[model samples]
Target: MIKLPTISTYYGGKGSSGTYQKIINHVRPHDTLIIPFLGNCALTRRIQWPAQVIANDLDPYIIDQWRNAELGPRLDLYNLPALDFLATVLKRPNLGRVVIYCDPPYPLGSRKSQQLRYHFEMTDRDHEELLTAIRFLRVDCLVSTYPNERYAQQLSHWNRTEFQSQTRHGAATEWLFYNYPIPEVLHDTRFAGNNYREREYIKRKAARWVAKWALLPPHEQQHIMEQLIIVTPNVIVNQINN
Candidate 1:
């Protein structure tokens, strides 16, 4: 978990630092993650990254900030329109197990204020196009948005989960829509529970297991790990299918 320097903030950044755990609870493994709507990259920065990560934003200032961070050679940063970036990426070959996580500008129709605050604000039409593009993508996709009628109608078939979050204006319900079912194997197990209490309970339970395992003899530990390796895949497959 090498942490990169934090990027500067933007107006209406949709910084998910507060709610990222909730959103990440629904994530699963992928070879690469594409963030076409990278703002401050709050959620992206916090996640357990995959083999590769590509983030894009139309705003040059935001991309420049990321570039200045020297985010290392592994991260591919782009300053391109979201849809165009997606289209270009899709054309590339051998993209195995890609996941696109979009935190696009909140639709004006769903917001309290009619005034646009972002460097690039999205209209209802813009949201429609984005949602449509996501719908047709062959690989997995996850989107964060408010509970808007147009969004609901467009992504009606997609699976959705929500979390209560605090915004500058006050409390709000943030929805995460995914094309896949909730995975049996998570991308990161650090945020594994439904709520704060449950998460703490899981943390304690894992700690207890770790302590108990540490007390076991070397032979016993090896035997247990071997058995688990032999059994886990089938169990996971069964759980996912059901």
Candidate 2:
């Protein structure tokens, strides 16, 4: 029988105690850390490392929150463009092993509408660019994402591993993609939500808007109004219709 570390024991309230411990166990003290889209740094603050740490995200609000932390001085927090951030990191003198922990946005099409704001709907080309940029780092990186077929296919090129675990509220199966092989252990799992009306409402509205937009002609687009207004004379014309 194969046994893995039980995470339930260190599931601290609100913050991360067990997950950080697991991360620390995986990474040595000297490894440089990079956490992308760190929301409040709930899991990151617990990482006990003697090396340098960099927390990056496209959201200025998130970066501001992280920067305001009492322990913010220890970690390097950057509020820059994602590609620019990668470029800056690449140019650093000491390009050692970097452990990147990314929790990118999972667009579920909610009323809040964070998709456009965060540009969460990443394509294969975007992931390929990211993979190429960070592949040279001399360390293992862990990325957490919701289970999706497109994402799985995109990451299939890497050595992939899956870990099935239940969150505090629900059961989730997470995949871990690594450059190297890791141990796989079997864990006995248990079973499992109803807001059907709300979901249907969103779906219907989205479909309606999509259909409306699809029917719109090229010249009838919103941008066309600006050009039309510019070309039209401001003077009033005599109305003559036959």
Candidate 3:
């Protein structure tokens, strides 16, 4: 049997699909969305971004994968440093109502260093550059990071969000900072259940029930299988009629 690489097999960062939709709610296809620091390009593959979506990163390999990801004509992936490319894109005129999402390398000083790993590791200066750049930007932006005393102290004026996420490492809490108020649509997570996580949950739930049934004693298992033969056909017929 051949083992397939799951979503986690992609190194470094992968954004939650639900989070991606919240980011999507703010815009339509006519707007320009810039993802300055594309880690796993999760933001790219997960949603059909309405407007033009431009994404860039420091790594060429990631750029290759991003371009080849079959997202469609609206997405333009590039290999470039995050700050410089972002600055260039922001400067472009007539682009109008730009939405820049900065999901960058976690700084060494941040508490997130324990759970997060990145090949393009960010230093203290890099963190400062990123935060300062976003603060002054005229464009609307969403920045993802984790909680830290220094960040709270430095960015006290900006709005912060504690997003719920889980990992095998444990139930993890990540953060998001925005220069402007996040839209009410993003805050409402009720519809977010339509993603892969819910489907995976249902699949695992069914598997557990089947596994428990297998563990029954031989006679019981035989009796149950016999019963299933009679019950399964009727159930299938009812489902087909429905």
User: Which 10 consecutive positions of candidate 3 have the poorest summed lDDT?
Assistant: 184-193
Model 1 is weakest, by summed lDDT over 10 consecutive residues, at 8-17
Q: Sorted by lDDT, highest first, which candidate order results?
A: 1, 3, 2
- Please, what is the TM-score per model? 0.89, 0.53, 0.66
lDDT tens string, model 1, 49-99? 877788899989888877888767668888898999999887777667788
Displacement of residue 187 (Cα, Å) in model 3 is 12
lDDT of 2: 0.50
Q: What is candidate 3's CA lDDT for residue 26?
A: 40
* Best candidate (score: lDDT): 1
TM-score, candidate 2, is: 0.53
Better of 2 and 3 by lDDT: 3
Structure candidate 1, residue pairs in collision: none
Q: After superposition, how far is residue 71 of candidate 1 from its true place, in Å?
A: 1.2
The models' CA-based lDDT, in order, is 0.80, 0.50, 0.63
Task: Give residue 200's lDDT in candidate 3 (0 to 100).
Answer: 65
Provide the lDDT at 153 for model 3. Answer: 62
- The better candidate by TM-score, 1 or 3, is 1
lDDT of 3 at 175: 72
